[model samples]
Target: MKKITLLLLFPVLLIAQEKATTANTAQSGRYDTNKFSQMYDLLATPNMFRTASGAPGPAYYQQQADYKMDIELDDKNAKLHGSETVTYYNNSPDSLEYLWVQLDQNQMAKDSQTPLAESEKMEQTFPPSNFADKFLKKELERGFVIEHVKDAKGAPLSYTINHTMMRINLASPLKPGTSISFAIKWWYNINNYQTEGGRSGYELFEKEGNRLYVIAQFYPRMAVYNDVEGWQNMQFWGGGEFALPFGNFDVNITVPADHVMEATGELTNRSEVFTAAQLKRYELAQKTFDKPVIIVTQQEAEIAEKGFSDKKKTWKFSAKNVRDFGIATSRKFIYDAMAVQLNDKVVMAASVYPKEANPLWEETSTRTVAHTLKSYSAHTFDYPYPKAVSVSAADQGMEYPMICWNFGRPDENGNTSEQIKNAMIGVVIHEVGHNFFPMIVNSDERQWTWMDEGLNSFMEYMAEVELGTNFPSRRGPARKIVPYMSGDQKFLEPIMSNSEGIIQFGNNAYAKPATGLNILRETIMGRELFDHAFKVYANRWKFKHPTPEDFFRTMEDASGVDLDWFFRGWFYSTDVVDIGISNVKQYYVTETPTQELKNSRVKKGRFDLEKGPFVYLVEEDNKELRARDKKALKIEDVTLLAEYVATVSDTEKDAFKTPKYFYQVTYNKPGGMLMPILVAITYEDDTVENFKYPAQIWRKNNQNAVKVYATEKAIKKIQLDPELETADIDLTNNTWPKESLKSKFD
Candidate 1:
């Protein structure tokens, strides 16, 4: 057949073959309805409170709840007692009939339903200790013991406790632009965090008869009331975190006289609590920016641990515009602090750890804190608080307003492996970066885990990489997420899932979204645009509440890029990217028709030969046609072509270059996800050219696409996603000449 005739028939033959294959198939259906559409159905409609541009609308308002607490840590009893007076200012347009308080300590109650909600399965072999801890231990007395709830006038207020939440009824509906004052007196038995597994508690050292307390969620806190989910009274089921309104705090914590304490706020009476020598060291640390200055040396801490001081000292602290409060206190803590300059302001980076955390904690904890503040502040907003503290605890990595609990303990002899060291630094960065995420940016972590954990983890990866090469980052690299992205569908959940609903907590809540943002920064949007948009999101939402829509809208609005496709695929669906080169064909230029064309014309009774100037295509494999053309024709022998070239203008000739080779490249997508097509084309001269087509290229053809290119050099090979930027799952079909697979033996 003639080349033109064969080309025309190819599509028809393909249609026939496709129809035959469909007839033989047992199961066939239409396309998935949820695959390609926008996320309108899944997202709430934009309103005046939150505009389409992702900025807070004119009507946006947030409530404020200030606290004045007098907390006492009963070290001998392993308990916490507090009397808090909350001053709530209602700034919303609507009236509040009642106030919801989060009693998170109730999650550990002996009668708590959290344990019942989990499913227990029998193990093949269980250790005697594990079996006893799981099934034999007597239930401990847990949850808050509410003493009294009273109004500002000292009148008893009506309240009811249900699970992990409490409702306080008011005498009248609290009007907007009004304030109310109430008091709550409560106490709870602090569990051993190492044994009970909690965000905060104490780690006991039986041999030394000492304990390190890392405390949070220790008091009655007000739940967030905002435009979205009016009253975020979601019960604390243990996985999803808190959603609290921003407020100021004045806390007076009374503990053992020998204890060294670091809390969420600035210590108001530092001189009163610190000795002469310790006060001098802390003052020196405030000016020392290069390295940490020991406020309480390990030797002093060890000596203090031996003495059970009967006298108590009260440490007063006051924090402004913070959402939560946490404190770490221990007589065994070796306290150190250093200064870090951030934009016109100087902030302190401090570490409080037991002697067991020496070497690793002393050498890296304060440094990691300083690095995190610099890195996160550069990307997001400045560290607004006075200090960022990292307290070493056993198997605990959790964040609060100005302080966080990190796990990095060396052996008894102070020796740690590289893996342990990396984990220490990584966790410190991750927890400290949280100050920029939900802590100040204030996303609701109860509803969306990725908003806080994922974003913070991504920042952690960046800080880790900036710290040094071979930093062993755990997330925020495209390649690191491949195994989870391509895992069994049954075991996978989209990043949009609730914290409690996730199947694989680590991958779903942290790794996937972090990797997605990395891909956006390095591959999709480029670093410049991504960083600017990210900073915009951070600054716009700082000290405020932001929903998922606000974040998605702010990124696009700031960057001038439409990223709905990315959000829909990466966050809303369990889709994987898999683009490959399906087929390739090469063609050469010719002036004369071959024998097949002549036969085709004669068979069709057509005699239009030599009627007009025409160009023909000859396949590279057609040797007979090439041999005939070589013997009968020359470069200047084509009369029609020479006539065309002679008539063209000088400007046109200078602007155009004749192509020596023509190529038809076809790309196919076997996976459901859509991503930018990054191609690397190689020439026979050992040179390469790269081209990137936006993801919109798949709009017209979702399954496959055909692209034609003309080049001066013969095409040698082609590669799709040469750098693995899209997290493409399957690489076997990514190349034109498929790479060979190695056998197990080989």
Candidate 2:
């Protein structure tokens, strides 16, 4: 995912090698030179308007909320019914006049103001969100605004719906630092998140004449309270994900008697809900440390699918601290669980897909989830949840903590593309990685989208790479970013922009940031440093609100590298990397008399004269090579020297030292982004040498920087970061003795 921010300047500090006595201090200073001041300024900007203390402050703070929900899915009517009791802890010092609840599903209502506005603008070329049509047709829509405001004691309280937000007017102001418990009963239509074109909901995957359920965002929940926005009023406009308050939930979902289900939390009443065989199998799965033990078999699913029993079975789940809850259930759902040993505990890596997902999702999805848990844990934090689920759906892949929806399907003849397989694996990894980014490492995504999408996408790339060589990572590879970086600058954005307003949508906001972080990890700071810092950030801010500054600061702080420049150049500005080897000059040392050297070669003469000053006689005492088999020296070996310095006294010999060759190679940074210059220089004797100059070399002069190499062998060729990665954007300048352009078409 690209993280597009507005352009901003960063301070640059260059370090000279001679001045720094300590290597550690010098390296730290060099890395810190390019710090992102813009992020700090933006985050620190005070807002007084929403201040509860009558002073400047952040607008809202998400309270730790707990919910006890009793829900029933009326599949026959395509409706969802739920009544949840929410306990909201007021951490803010100020008292709340009212609390707002987000009715996300309302956006799908036919009469919604957004859809109405969108419908008027819709032409044949532009289609409505996939969930829009499904919401209006296949899903039942009712109780458009069926909610009652209540106090902690269950007494009625005044409430108002100002468009998308339902404001509950408390009977009396809930004082500062207080907890408010209330209940709201709500039900909504169920539609696939990506049916016609929408982003969340359920898709009906048929297997053995049974339809499997893949559900998401089926109910209304609370909006986020943050520093920037008091309450996020941004409507679920289809593609973008959600921003919510962290809380606990006790959800009870009831479906048909025979239907099996899996959701966001553990099944609290498994004994009451599952059959004797399921209980025994569940116990076995707990010990099955390797592969998944099937809880619901295909034959049982087919039998259940034959009759859509109206009898509802309640499956209770209680999550201690969670932001949201989602579930997938169906008689045709094929469920499997594999034990993933994280740290010492065993977390279940599960998958729920139809027979269509067979040969693909059935085999790889769970394993990919396992991989995500492992790789991401190594980089960020451990898999704390008991289970991580991957459910097969169509359209865009979305992530939620411990639960994610994936997209992949086989051909009519059961043939699937390697592309599809890799894509599924990658998507699953990307989604599950989200459990770390916005979910546990809770960030205000609406305000700073990059914090969630960009960071998750970055880890997504790393996780994918760890998965295998052919893991088809679409967003994280640096080389894959060139096209987007080189695109029309007018249509681009820096990764620091507001989520909704960024240009170039997907690539600019999501993929670029991911690639930028990858470049920083691989080519800039390296894996060891980057991973440690990233993990620190994740662990430090888990379940709390973190801004972009928190992330930038924590990474640099933990890594002990001043990454200001990296954040500034990559996140705040639309800078492209286009560095090249501008020039290379070679020189040789000679020892001869001044006059003869100057006269023999004017270009050679001056060289001869310079050599003459340091000339030493083949001493009479040096008689070691006087053997009969020894060949005589040529004039070139004992050249006729310039005579100017031929008469050196004994005292001059005491001051004389052997001359060394020097070559100055100049490099140009056509790209605004500064990176370490990794240059490979080939010598005349078919030998290669590498010279590294820290990024600070360009701090003093961003135009062209020159480096002098003192070597015995003459440089034959030179190349810079030959792999064509680093998101260089332009490789034309990447080599000395410019490579000849070849026409592939010809």
The regions of model 2 sitting more than 4 angstroms off are 1-62, 111-144, 192-195, 205-211, 227-229, 588-661, 741-746
Per-residue CA lDDT of model 2 for 1-746, tens digit only, reads 32221110101111223555776763523433433333444444434322211122354455777778788888876677777777777777567777778776666665567555442433444356544563456544522446565666778867776555677877778776888788786666666444434556556644544455665666557777655556676765544567788887778888888788888888888998778997888788777866677876766766777787868798887776677777878776677777878787788888877666676766688778888889988887787788888888766587776788888878777788998888888788888888888888877765677888888888888887776676667888878888888999888888888766776777866798888788778877888998888877788777777777667777777788877777788888888888888876543322322232234333333233343234322211223323321222222343333232244566865675432345667899888887778888887787887767777788778878987665655567788877755788777777777886465575
Estimated TM-score for each candidate? 0.92, 0.81
Q: Residue 14 of candidate 1: its Cα lDDT?
A: 16
lDDT by residue for model 1 (335-446), tens: 9999999999999999999989988899999998999999999999889999999999999999998999998778888899998998999999999999989999999988
Candidate closest to the true structure, highest TM-score = 1
- Provide the overall lDDT of each model, using Cα atoms, as 2-decimal numbers: 0.88, 0.69
Candidate 1 whole-model C-alpha lDDT, 0 to 1: 0.88
lDDT of 2 at 276: 95
Clash count list over all predictions: 0, 42
The model with the greatest lDDT is 1
